[model samples]
Target: MNNYNHILAKSVENGATTLESHLESVADFAVVAARYAGMDTEVALQGALLHDIGKASVVFQKRLRSKPSPLELPFRHEIASLFFLKLVSPDLQPFMIDMIVAHHKSIYKDVSGTGIIDLENEYEEDILQFHLSDFSLWASEAIGILAELKFPGVTHETVITEEDAREAYYFALDHCRKRQKGWSQWKGLLMGADHIASAVGDFKEKVPALFADPDVSFYNRKGELYPLSLIDSDGTKKHTFVKAPTGAGKTDFLIKRCRGRIFYTLPFQASINAMYERILHDLGDHVEDIRLLHSISQLLIGEERITEKVIQDKFGASIKVLTPHQLASIAFGIRGYESVLFDLQGCDIILDEIHTYSDIMQAIVLKMIEVLNHVGCRIHVGTATIPSALEKEILEILGKEQVQYVQLSDEVLTLFNRHEIYKAEAFTDLLPVLQQAVEQEKKILIVCNRVANAQVIFEQIEELYPKTKKMLIHSRFKRGDRNRLEKELKNEYNVSPYACIVVATQVVEVSLDISFDLMITETAPIDALIQRFGRINRKRTAETIGKYKPIYIIAPPQKDPDCLPYNPKILRDSFKVLPDGGELLRETELQSLINQVYPKVEMLNIDLDAVFVDGKWRLKELWHLPKSALIEKLDIDSVVCITQEDDESGKYREADKEERILMEIPVRYSSLRWKRLKQLDIGAHPFVVPDIAYSSERGLDLAKTGAENYDTNYQIW
Candidate 1:
């Protein structure tokens, strides 16, 4: 053990981290994670201890000692570590092999591939020269350390001859072909442990516990007891489904049903952001237990607390608010999916607002549900409105008898009726209605189907009423601008009660808490329309229960070939069911209207089986595919947009390159749009937009072309 002190695993600015020290740290963390998962801790500890033993090779040390390491090719230390697996018991050989070889990269390459060594071309004769004199000394030291740590059936005399090393390497290659389930768990634990030890600079530091049994009294105290909350959710910890209108205490009910750590998922980033803030505000004392995860998570969490991003990524919080797409990696068996699966095991998950997703996204969500259930998660789904046909499909998948279905009472639903419906020909027809609302000094909300259309209507309103206070909000704005607008809308419209007009796109549909006196929106799917209606007359109190706020529905565009953003058939059906002449819109009739519009599951035209079939195929080939290949297949092209303020303040420019702010734009901007914008880079910054294209008042100008569109294509999906 004394002789082995000369070997180094990593060279630090202060000094070298000895091979023994690094191995011990990794082993300790690995054992902790493995025991928590109810796995074989001894096997995990052994795998981690042996993972970096190859760094003891004389060639590696020589490379490290070089003033600037002259090695041109990447060192294959993981492959070198495979030479010592013979020391482990024969039954545990497979586990050791999988954990060691796949800790940094995939083990199996292809169905016909020979061994892990072939994946790396660093086996030149010159680099194969080992310090044979020191090999026995280092091996004995490792064995002694393992024994000191109370590892069983291993000793200092466990020799590794050339013959034994060759046999062990071949055995590992054969074991990789089996693709055992235990191997995935073992490999994930080892990787997670190594990452944590490296990030914290020591394994001795206390790692935060991933699960907690906190008292949810804070949520319960402020919560209004709804009919759903009264239903007994204490028995059996079974899956639950709630079909209740918005503002009916559904979120509180979902939280009450959880039995363990929670993963609360939403359909959109905006909704997830809002949910994160809501939970943080309600559970302020347990702030460290909750995390917000999304593309712009760093920005959403605030620049001062950016370290939270690293903490959340390495060790997940007890409660996480994120979009379902964050978990899509598991469905595709992409790299790092194992870590996500590990975090979700035995946790309770809440899928809120599940009805507002595209067909493909819905299919992905369904696949996610099946996988989450398979991993022992207790799923609770809450939605304001879902078609009976889709509801039946979800029930059949969850096993109808296994779920506790709860619905708002018909009498309670009657109390939420607060909208009066009106049919208008187009945006032009709604202009007069808008003017009257403004003259009457009432808060107004107008929603358009597309950003282009929203901008057109906003300009028209601005021109017509020059003296009115108005704001335009959509998905195209830079991230910073959107955050400011959200804060402004919450303060001015919600707190002080002002008279103003807000022209927006479908972005206003989900989770935003502001309520308006009037709303005018273009025709969309019934579910989206229901969500839009919720934004108006949101608080269903005695003062607002019987009073019907007008919600004008404009007819679908006449000459457009594709209704787009929404199905034409669904729009026509939705329009046909609208109450004429501003009739009182009862919440009790909401589900019935949705059933009429989406009578059968096929109406959505989603290929629900496609994701499942693909997932199964990927699982079969999981061992064979490299992570890089998997990531390339799942890559979605996106850009990051920074405002002039962000760029000039050095908040995003002068900070650590990795700590820059990322404001993800909406996904509607296609790759073609990005190409066009990139061509117009105006030299101030390669990606920064021209001054004329963006404004604090109007947001990103989608109508701007050429140089004006320079950095506007920053939409992230």
Candidate 2:
């Protein structure tokens, strides 16, 4: 066998490539990333070059081949790698330790309770000797590789004793234990580079353009219909707050107002998908990189579908459209947060439709705002319905002096008086009107608050309007199914000259770009309801300005328990504040109505489990809390599932993201409790639901959930 293909001699690069090349690849990426982040490239190169050198040990080589190479005590490569700290400068050793020690394991309380500090306290002398076990035999080989590079601190013929390893471990421990309150850019840089290197072999060739601003002049075209576009976006303020009706051009105005690389955040995956497609279409020709940040974003939404799971969150995207959940790690200091924090620094983040989420979620979002501000990001908020109290709280955080509050003029607001509100006791009450609309060949939309409710209505509508084209969309469909639903919702039914009805849930509330002739929606919060109203008569041109469409809103659920995921009082107040009985729901009165519903922001104290609190970072530098810790504090129950029919457990294990994403479905963990289901031992432990519970038309049928397995006749494969 040739030297390059000699598999028996390989120890690093997962036993697939040479170790020397891997170190060089990581150094190339790290140096480039450090330059982009304005950090010292020399330190970054040295850190990257030495982080994985412990793999050169003969014990590690045997272990890679599944040979019995157990030591007297346990071994951690991160620990063994610390023995060669003499190869680094004293001034830069601290930075290198942060990069190497916790790149794979946590510094302090690793989930396995085996971090460097963990063993350091348990067996001080013994731990050092275990890492230095047979070190004399392999240290020369590791040193020879380093000496070949001829970098600054590569000392020749190093004869380090157990005492030297002990001293190095304590030095790193002391540095981390007595650290200050800022995130380490060096650690983040190394992590990003290493992740990029592992996922893509040629890091230099694969890393996209970094830290370049995208040209958003495409949104600068002024039109009479879009009132906000006519307003002056250039101002002395550093941040912005714009509250206008949905069709009043909030998205375009926000994009045009940005001065740096943009982080466009939305509330839902569907909204992000729509915004990504729109931005890419408008800006893809001019910008080299405009990405959508989500787990299954590539396969379901884009042309360049990424099959390999590379670290897509690295800085340098001209614009990235994502949801708040993707940025939650920074607020709680969860895994991979430092890299995300580094990416968001000094960018223009547009928080679009920031009015959803429960009280706890609101606190999380506010915490995100605090962190973004701390990192020097310019925050811009755009919304159709924002309560006075919430707006005031956001202003206080962003600082009233720094925010440019923009509102549409009264005349322009009056021009958006497109929805005429009607009161309904139940969905059954709208049957006569819905039938009339369908008979008149009008496009119709129906919105329910929950998936089950949407499915029930969709089945009923499907049976009643057998001749009319119909579809159902919500948060529960499989990735591929939802992609198809969204495409048909936007293109097929939405544009077909023939009449159609789309029954959906709250997914349609925010930035989903769709228009219907009329709508019948369930009652939600005033802010949410206003966003839903935007879907009706939404194409606001000169011709559509004066034209009015009808919307029927069912009254709020009477019982408080049934009004879960929303405040009962807020729901009642939102319903009461609105004009009913075929009255024109004037866009001018939306803010007042919203303020009446939400008189004050419900502030919750989450400082006990948060990274940022009272304008201070609780998480110390060089350390990050475990994902389990953050998951517990956040009380997040959402989980993923794959239908038994679409079961690709074999493919999913093989890292086929494109195929695996299509098989997966997003459902709440609580919803699957005490139920008979099969779980795959993967991230989030994806559950396998029986085929009887899902439909391509209406999504998962909760009523069909049972202790039944997939039938051979129904399985896709």
TM-scores for all candidates: the values are 0.83, 0.93
Please report the TM-score between candidate 2 and the true structure. Answer: 0.93
lDDT of 2 by residue, 1-717 (tens): 113222222445353766666777778888887887789989998988888877776666657777563444656777777777876779889888878887776677766767777778777778777677787777777776676666565656556565676778778778767879868887788887777676666434655676778899999988888888898886688899998888888999998889989999988788888898899889988987777887657554443434223545555678988888888888888778887887888899999988876677677788899999988999999988887887888999999899988998888889989988898889998899998998889999998888888888988997898989999999888878888888888988777777899999888887888888999998899888888888888887777778899989998888988786677888888888888878998877888787787777778877777888888888877677877344454444377887765554455666555667776788777788777667877644688777778877767876666555557543441
Q: How accurate locally, in lDDT, is each candidate?
A: 0.69, 0.79
Error of 1 at 10 (Å): 6.9
How well does model 1 score by local distance difference test?
0.69
Model 2 ranges off by over 4 Å: 1-17, 67-72, 148-150, 153-166, 202-204, 301-311, 628-637, 648-655, 682-684, 709-717
Clash pairs, model 2 backbone: none
Where in model 1 is the C-alpha error above 4 Å?
Answer: 1-28, 53-75, 109-164, 180-183, 197-207, 217-225, 302-307, 464-468, 603-618, 621-637, 642-653, 657-659, 662-669, 672-692, 702-717
lDDT of 1 at 121: 31
Q: Which number leads on lDDT?
A: 2
